[model samples]
Target: MTLPPIRFTADEAWALAAALAAADACAPYAGAARTAYQKIAASMTGPVSVAARELAARIVALPSRTDAAVRAAVEEALTGNKALRLSSVDAEGRESDRVVEPAGLLTADGRWYLIAWCRTRRAGRGFRLDRITAAAPTGERAQPHDLAGLLLGSVAAGAARPVALAALAPPS
Candidate 1:
């Protein structure tokens, strides 16, 4: 059976662009998403379309700064619901190895961060992509955790929340 065309807003498009751009496997999906964004923008009225087109262009043009191999491993951990072994350096330049349950990836300010429940600290942590020296799938299934809850309640110091697509809405 043929499916009806799906409708998505500019905000959703921007969110998807931000999420996909941080991944190593962004090439194929980015192209398709851009085409879809253009189509959606065409269907929108007035400034929304203009804003969407501009945002689409900017988001697509922004280069990913996350290390490819590390991004891949974290992505795998998330997709496979497996734990991730991470070797990362703290701000003070101390390196530590830890296992974490990959919850989500946040990209902001041209940087990527892996949000996870840390086994080392027994708490949630947002490991910056640049700080991660290595990432590998641990093959062990991750413990169940709610991402929204983790984001809201964690003691992740200086954890400025990731923006929602609705926050990117064009001025009213």
Candidate 2:
């Protein structure tokens, strides 16, 4: 018996291309689908596709992962599902106390951003990892929130905001 060739629509093809291009392990399949991938990539115009492509470029350009301290903080918060007390300075040079339930960590444009549920603002906020002077586990489990929703909300809320590192601060 012979099987019929499978066919994919433009949307499906585009999704497959993006997935393959975003992963190093899929390089072989990506090479095989080069032509289709290019065509789909070039034709991408939807908001989601455009955002995804832009993010993919940034991820590719990142020099390295977040620093060891930031990585450790994020790991502890995520693993324990706990709130992180962050010592951070805002753009206006105001030092603030922020307790957040970390939702996710993302690297874009050679920087790390932490998406979290801010207890102070009573809303979701994204903080630049470099700007965080210190992060300590609160030892209190976080109140559950929809992490995927928070991340998607961050994208809609403009993930390009300029947040800077605290000047003259020691690592915590």
Candidate 3:
């Protein structure tokens, strides 16, 4: 389906650039969005007669996603229902069918992780969403534990930290 091009004001583009720098996976999308906005700023004819060269300068710089496959993959993963389950390949080359009560999604160190409650283990687990082979919700809801609170007051805190740090952060 063909969609109309997006339009953005100069101010909007500048604001978007600032926001994109702080964002993780969406940075590429932000760049594309900014480009559309810049085009609008140039052709805009009204009382505001801005310089053309300065228009580009106001744009927020972001990592470009030239690969169609990568862009599609990222779009598919992030758009639509954030609550939906996803299937992807994992690190060990094993298919992991997990019923996760997804709490939040995080991208750290260039990898996307789902912070969810794993039904099989009956615990809060961080799954590398990209590695998931397949994901489908069971229509069954599981109680999510406040892992942060539990770990803060338990021995698990020590274990979660590095060995060197764990020794210093032992359970009180």
TM per candidate comes to 0.59, 0.50, 0.43
Please identify model 1 stretches exceeding 4 Å from their true place: 1-63, 152-172
Worst 10 residues of 2 by lDDT: 23-32
lDDT (Cα, 0-100) at 47 in candidate 2: 68
Name the weakest run of 10 consecutive residues (lDDT summed) in model 1: 21-30
TM-score of 2: 0.50
lDDT of each: 0.69, 0.64, 0.48
Best of the candidates, TM-score = 1
Report RMSD (Å) for each prediction in the order shown: 6.8, 13.6, 11.2
Worst 10 residues of 3 by lDDT: 64-73
Quote the lDDT for 3 in model 1: 41
> Between prediction 1 and prediction 3, which has the larger TM-score?
1
lDDT of candidate 2?
Answer: 0.64
lDDT of 2 at 24: 35
lDDT of 1 at 51: 60
